[model samples]
Target: MGRKAKHVLLTGGLVSGLGKGSVLAGIGRSLQDRGIVVNVIKIDPYLNEDAGGMSPAEHGEVFVLEGGEEVDQDFGVYERELELILSGKNNITTGKMWKRIREKERRGDYGGRTVQYFPDFVNEIEEWLSSVSQTTMTRKGIQPADVCLIELGGGLSSYEIDIYLEAFGRLRSKYGKENFLHIHLDVLVDVLGQFKTLPIQDSINRLKRKQLTPDLLLYRHKNEINSGAKVKLSETCMVENLFDIPFLENKEQLCGFLSKSGVVECISEQLKLELKSEKGLVAEWKRLHRLAPEPGKVVRIGIVAKYNINHDAYLSLTKAICDCARSLRYSVEITIIDAEQLEEGLEAAIAKLLIADGILVAGGFGVRGVNGKIMACKHAREKRIPYLGICLGMQVVVIEAARNLLGLYDATSTEFDPETANKIILKTENSKENQGGGSMCLGAKKSEILLEDSLAKKIYKNSFVIERHRHRYEMNVEYAEALKEKGVVVTMVDEKTRMPSFVEVRGHPFMVGTQSHPEFTSSIFTPSPIYCEFLKAALENKKCKTSMGLNTTNE
Candidate 1:
């Protein structure tokens, strides 16, 4: 029999949005560096089955896994930092938990006893944690090194959080203290130039009331923790492992900062894991950090989307653009424009679009912002501005092409106008499936580049590629010949489904759209090719404007 895995529970106190996700990623990376196979699980207290239906404005971005699960944005952080592939199971929500329990009860799996929340619900959570950890280990085909890091969402004082604490305490007792470690994260603010510890002290007291004592206290502060404040925290909190964690300027500094502050070492010791030197990892991080672009040259890219209010909704897309810009040694300035604003009028939208060196139409659902996105796409296409479209954004490009170029005024997607001549048709596989939620085509799939002289093929530098997808529509094959008759080019198609995967405009500096989401696979180390090429073109556009000395009103 294999040794049981160790568990680390991280919970936030005082306030939320204290960079808990980043801190968790740093710890996971450090553990991975020490030859430890680590798996991370995120516990969200929301009633939603997944983050897919949540408003990006409120909950942030919904990260899509290769398996097509729309999860919390933190999963993207874990993937980017640890360079590991995660699945839908990594993100556990209260709604998912309740759904499972109710299903079991409906099927009489609970043996007709009244389903209670205490032992039954709590026991289900623990069993789920164990099952997911083992399942990930088996799937990865690696040696069984059971070290799972679970992050509980929301503030420590909330009732939702109390339930998790109760379950965690029970799990600790079942697994033994040596096998469990709890890390508490808190915020420190400067009140009139003096560091305050009262919030965290109160938070710790609240935690103790729930029978949970933190093994480590990670303080998120803007300034340095003075000696007097440190002593006060140590004495009041009764935690010797007190560490100050400042807000990082960039992702490159995460691993280095964690290592320097000895937080990684403290976690390693508490988890009973051997500490290995992170010299190699640190050096690589520093190398990349030094490669960041200097200030001055800025290429502004405008993102037109429905969820422009909350930038977190487009976290991966924004991150991909940043990563690509950094690699090219140019700073990128992003301008987010709500597509609904464009629907109000074209003059205002065009003014904003023209100021950008390039334009990107992001993927979205529903017909709420479709007209506005279509307007933005048309402006980018006609103006010869660098453009990249994704999913619904790509469908917008096809619809615009059919209407403007091919003279198909009635061209539309069945999703928005089921009665109109559908230029973007629903796939046969998805035709009978109900709309919305997880019913759409999801996960990683393969596509082959069909055009040799296309921007997508040039950026990819290959005939074939695999990209993550999360959409229900595809380019209508019936319009392929008509679109080809114009200047529109079908650049790529899926190997199995023969679905059009990529499209481009001939003679444009850079105009490309993809059914697959290249942003999902993008990382700091390896930027997505589509974004890279788009940013590169934007840089050239910026240079042209600088040389010509034309200052636009939007800038």
Candidate 2:
């Protein structure tokens, strides 16, 4: 329908985890800030339809966006950096790739020909990118925006990513060179006090071998870009110099670097977009500051997660939590507590726990540090502290309550209950024997939340609601009636299947556990309904503590 699509593919030369996600995010933000509507797609090399059922420790938490698609963490980066919202369509893994190919074959869409990897597989990727970018418009929905940024997961050298590289090369011919911009992300190592371009040089050489040359190279490192390295790189790679590092000391410097490279102006001129002042986007970031409470009075919330250091792991959830914080006009401070680290004394953990007005145990798979999360939830419930649980988090709370209150000492999930006689976990009839990826409800599955006149209803303020889910193990239905008798209110259920979706205590200050994930529903302009309530509770708890302290002081 449209003339053609402007495309940008990001690939690396060396290994994985090279900050390619961040560079793409930065460019996405810079363009969107200048009033250029940007769309992003993540092409993961894994051979799964979705990252579902993958360990959060290994594959990172699967992010669900508005359209019920499970995407990569880059979607979160793009949302935070550019302040735009995307759906699962934004993320495409090799797993998701083959799924489409096999479906087409099943439908006889391949015209009875044996569909092999080369042309058929490669064409699926190109078709996916074009279809997604064209359909979901970021702003105003005018012709799929000015540019679509696509990030290739893993490195360019990986055989898994080779198909993606081939697709891009074919796309270049189809869309024309002017309609596409290739960006290669790499690091600039400062070895022995002199910048070594060997790493970057090797990366570029590999891309050249693939017949895909980078239009711009984003060098991401914790150092300055010296003139000599820039020249050597430009002459060798024939790339437009666009160095991106997080060393912007001032506004003047940032504006200068952006203007000098003609990044904003050039993009504007090429895409026929109006170059609005950077202040428009800068103004949006300032809104975050304005929403924060006074510095010392800010509330701290503890995020007990499996992968605490990998901030990318909790991208969408963190953004939703922050969005909730901003909605309540309070500056929120997040303390990352690795679930593995909580094996230490509960007395020692009390300092951090007491400092936090509210505690959130995020979603994760496996049993590596599950005991810590269960312990944290128990402390919150027993201490009457505000708490929120999501997905597997809800399951953890149920198991915790059963063990401590209901006298089930060895309650565990089916995932970990291979030979244990006291395993409280049960397997889904279909999922019990499935292999890997995409086993769970990775997409949007609607479960009716019949909010009773309890704390759950007060926070949600709605009787019936539906949300997304991505997990294999759930509170076993055989044990569900028993748990319900022990005062665990099943606040929500799937109308058709009659499965539990949310559970909570009868009366508490603030506590909720939902089998559905509300993080995917959160956006920049609109916070997730659950997160909004959680932030309100956290802020209100802060206010109540402040009032009580003042009263005691006056007495």
Candidate 3:
């Protein structure tokens, strides 16, 4: 009962790890460049309610939205690619769909009839897309989306995503063929020197079998897709629109590539939209690549992390650092120092830590590298090095400062050592242990700083600031004064819960920790105030070390 927005269905198959999210986001960026309002919807087929409870090793990073929704990492890609703040409502999972159906059943809205997956599921999905069209990104408000890009995860042939495909079929029928564009995204494999078309053919056949054919075939290759291969694919792949998405080291080139390759032109023609190219979106990427690397002027920041297997676990955090630092015209040199390295030898860890002017301890769960992270906090505090700790990082700051400054040797978080005498970080009272990791203090909360001259107040430029949180343990208010007496103060506290969220050391150049993750909302255009201030302090720290004739390089 609303105006129909153009719907584009993006499917994945024929091997994983293709930059489908980036490409889809790139295409969205291209459309937006032409003054089109584009909104992206990511449909995950997993049974989990959200990515919050998923393992970082198995599922990559759980990107937290501004509204505190833990979504797939692709959403992070979409935000950066489109430079728009999206809402959690845009992410749809099978678990979410099933829950909606059950709720409808409970309310007897289905007239007590049996709910089947065909028309019933399709109807629910239709309603979901319709509701999302009127939803805006960033906050809960109305700003009708002109185009909706639905990216489906779980390979094309999987049974988990068959319902979505079925739903798209009905959607195409209801909205007419012109309103929908189904895209099959995959990589064109090169075996030896031969370019194979069989995999691409087989994948499209699966889509046509479900009566849901893809109008566009956006594929990936290493510049191996020759003219003959393109013609061959066009002839056999059923649908005629074939676009080659070559691999690029810098993902920002996605839109620029799409524009050069005529993919953006074709999408606009097919959708019948009259538009003009602002040339603003692609220009930003060009500016970034145009900057030459500053040799000795680079700001080195050592990141003490526990997850070593997959770097995607810290994907957004790294992006925040690089984006904010670039705004200051300083090239970033991020060294992911494994916390386990510190546990084995403090002397070696200190050697590694001294090479960088600033040290950052990222948030993580488990007791594997707890002591190493605690030692890292102590090192940064005493050495006058700029430091920033997030979630678990903030907890370690308190634990380390309590042990060293307050003389509480047994101080530790309740999450790591529940039997410790000094439970500096107490388990949140609202957290439910029996319910399997659902009750977390998630989303954005208002933080109010008491001191007018505090660094946090200066960085935020406001006494009240809103930040996102994703933790279940918080700094205990019972020992707040005792910690303040030792030159550590809780500068920022949640306005709603009155829980201490931001902490700062008295005499350090820059030593601050927050229970919230500031990187989630950090953008190059409008960088996070905390990250901007932290990087500035790190640059100043480097200047001081250089004046002292200290060798900051690892070599």
TM-score on alpha carbons, each prediction: 0.93, 0.82, 0.95
User: Please, what are the lDDT tens digits per residue for candidate 2 over residues 1-555?
Assistant: 555457777787688877676656656666766766677778788876666555555677666655556666666666655556677677787776778887889999989988987789778877787777763344444345567888888876688777777778777777766777677778778887788888888888877766787776777566766788888877877776556554455323343444445555655554456667675564554464346455544677888877765666787788788777777666788877767767665554555666677889988777777888887888878766678898878888788878987788888887876766556666544464756644465555666656567666776677667677776777776676777677677878766667777888655678889888788766656678788777777777777777778311111
Across 360-431, the per-residue lDDT of candidate 3 in tens digits comes to: 999988888888888788888878889999889888889998899889999888888899999888988789
- Which residue pairs in candidate 1 have backbone atoms (N, alpha carbon, C) closer than 3 angstroms, thus clashing? none
* Segments in model 3 whose C-alpha atoms lie over 4 Å from true places: 138-141, 288-296, 346-351, 553-555
Identify the candidate with maximal lDDT.
3
Off by over 4 Å in 2: 33-36, 66-68, 79-90, 96-121, 137-146, 241-261, 270-282, 307-311, 338-351, 408-432, 435-437, 445-452, 476-487, 539-555
Task: Write down the lDDT of every candidate, Cα atoms only.
Answer: 0.81, 0.71, 0.82
Off by over 4 Å in 1: 134-143, 294-297, 346-349, 422-428, 431-435, 546-555
Clash list (residue pairs), candidate 2: 47-95, 48-95, 48-96, 49-95, 49-96, 69-88, 293-331
lDDT of candidate 1 over 1-555, digit per residue (tens): 777678889989856787888898887766776667788899998788998877777888878888889899998898877777888888889999999999999999989998988899898898888877753432356455558888998887667767777888777777766788889999887898799889999988887776678889998887766889889999999987888788778766866787677776777777678766553665564576567686655788999988866768899999898877877787888988879889988666667777999999999878888998988888888877788898888888899999899888888888788888554555546645564667677889899988887777789999999999888778888888888878788889999988898888888888888898899888777788888888888877777777778546223
Candidate 1 displacement at residue 489 in angstroms: 1.8
